[model samples]
Target: MHLHCYSWTGAGDDLRREGERRPPLPPGDLAAFRASPLPPMRTCDWLLKPATRIDTSPPTVTEAQTWLADRYGTAEPSFLHPADEARIGLDLRLKIAEESLAGGTDVLWGIWLKAGGFICLVVVCCSPNRHADYPCPCRLTSP
Candidate 1:
């Protein structure tokens, strides 16, 4: 399947492919995050703000894993079915909430996966500006 990325700032949608330039991240203060014992984390801004909201009814682990596989054509054996909300940092959650309130994104739709000794987020994102949905996969590491 052909994959694409989009810039969705509530403005016109600009579509691009994997080798092309990436879309700009919505307004957010990732630097505002205070120091912590965890190693430095890395991820694009779009991952924090999913274009679509997650379902109210939690998906089973198997369902989440299947979704991951279907979207990416592969799924990690350690993929966590439902997200471990408690694993996310409080400060980060606050930042995401603030950004969402500012209309930066709809919500965070994510699942957890264990990579080696670290835990990461495998999230889904799309272009809010266009009718077409381009699902993108991103990883977010947490303390």
Candidate 2:
């Protein structure tokens, strides 16, 4: 969906050429946030808002282990999946840690192996399968 508000028209867009700095954030939280090691966060301008969402169902720990090992070389037993709404994709960090292939890929792909070693590419997630959360126990539980 696209918004065709007056902002997209010539008049409002021209204001971009004369963009003004936004007022600084309120002091109460500003100092505390700035003191943190995390990257600075900022609000988006109304001129160009992002699409509502870019979601992928969280991958299973088993899948993450392979991708992480194939990339990070040390995903250890499994990833401690973050608990958050955005859940920023950590695949890029995995890439940085991996020894690159002879031919770099825009996207890394892989297959899932069955117990007998029969395998299939994970083209899409099939439901109602779901990954278990951390501290979930050493045993496997079918979703």
Candidate 3:
């Protein structure tokens, strides 16, 4: 079995492609930032849709990150270049999660399970403080 927690932009770019860190907004730019249209968090519905079952209850963000860290052997995951396939692991997950809570792209988190090289299950988690434009799917009783 292969397991990992992955994070990506809703637009489907590699996590490392977040480009340069965003600069601090000037006082006058506050209005622009406020007026900017932010999309609802990308729930990674593609992963959720085909499930025979989905466990809405997910581990906490720290728990999820730790899971990856333990498995990948990285105690402190710093933002670095993505692997050849653009797969996201602990580092990108942490960065995206932080950016999401700070009013950037609505990042989503999920635990991915693969067995025999085939994806088998996914567990979606609620965003930090439930800061989502839509209801928290993770809190749903049913898929």
Candidate 4:
């Protein structure tokens, strides 16, 4: 499985490209994501750097999500609103519940408001689901 995330524009070009699959975010998030600030390049340079050799085999989604949750507590409120659950017309409630057992890793993002930087972490750690857009396949529950 592959993962992709977005970092704000303030990041150095080389820094943003450090990861294997850093997919560009949607237009709306892109603007906000790019406007964000990043920590000192040197501080995270080692982490952001690309690996010497690509590893086609990576940890499973569940393993990755577990690692992330352990490192960063479930960041649910940022990507999903409480109201989106009941109000949503789709039948994703069950999926949401299951995915959230460990944490909201399937569809999660990291946003830095003060500095204005964003990174999207894709959770390919679970059974494949087509809903790439977080909070399900439809627009945010019209609330």
Lowest lDDT block of 10, candidate 2: 1-10
The total number of steric clashes, by the backbone 3 Å criterion, in model 2 comes to 0
Q: Candidate 3 — which residues are off by over 4 angstroms?
A: 1-52, 67-89, 101-143
Clashing pairs in 2: none
Tens digit per residue, CA lDDT, model 2, 66-101: 544443232212223323211534455444323222
Q: How high is the CA lDDT of each candidate model?
A: 0.31, 0.24, 0.32, 0.32
Model with the higher lDDT, candidate 1 or 2: 1
After aligning candidate 4 to the native by TM-score, how far in Å is the CA of 17 from where it should be?
14
TM-score each candidate. Answer: 0.21, 0.16, 0.28, 0.27
Clashing pairs in 4: 6-120, 9-34, 36-116, 36-117, 37-115, 37-116, 61-125, 62-125
Model 1 gets an lDDT of 0.31
* Tens-digit lDDT string for candidate 4 (51-77): 221112134444444444432333333
List candidate 1 stretches off by more than 4 Å.
1-89, 97-102, 105-115, 127-143
* Count of residue pairs whose backbone atoms collide, per candidate: 1, 0, 0, 8
The sequence of per-residue lDDT tens digits that candidate 1 reaches over residues 5-116 is 2122111112122212223245334333312222112223333333232222113333333333343222234444424544663346545644542442333323334432
Q: Lowest-lDDT window of 10 residues in candidate 3?
A: 112-121
What global local distance difference test value does model 4 have? 0.32
Give candidate 4 regions above 4 Å deviation: 1-61, 71-106, 125-143
Q: Considering every candidate listed, which one attains the maximal TM-score?
A: 3
The model with the greater TM-score, 1 or 3, is: 3
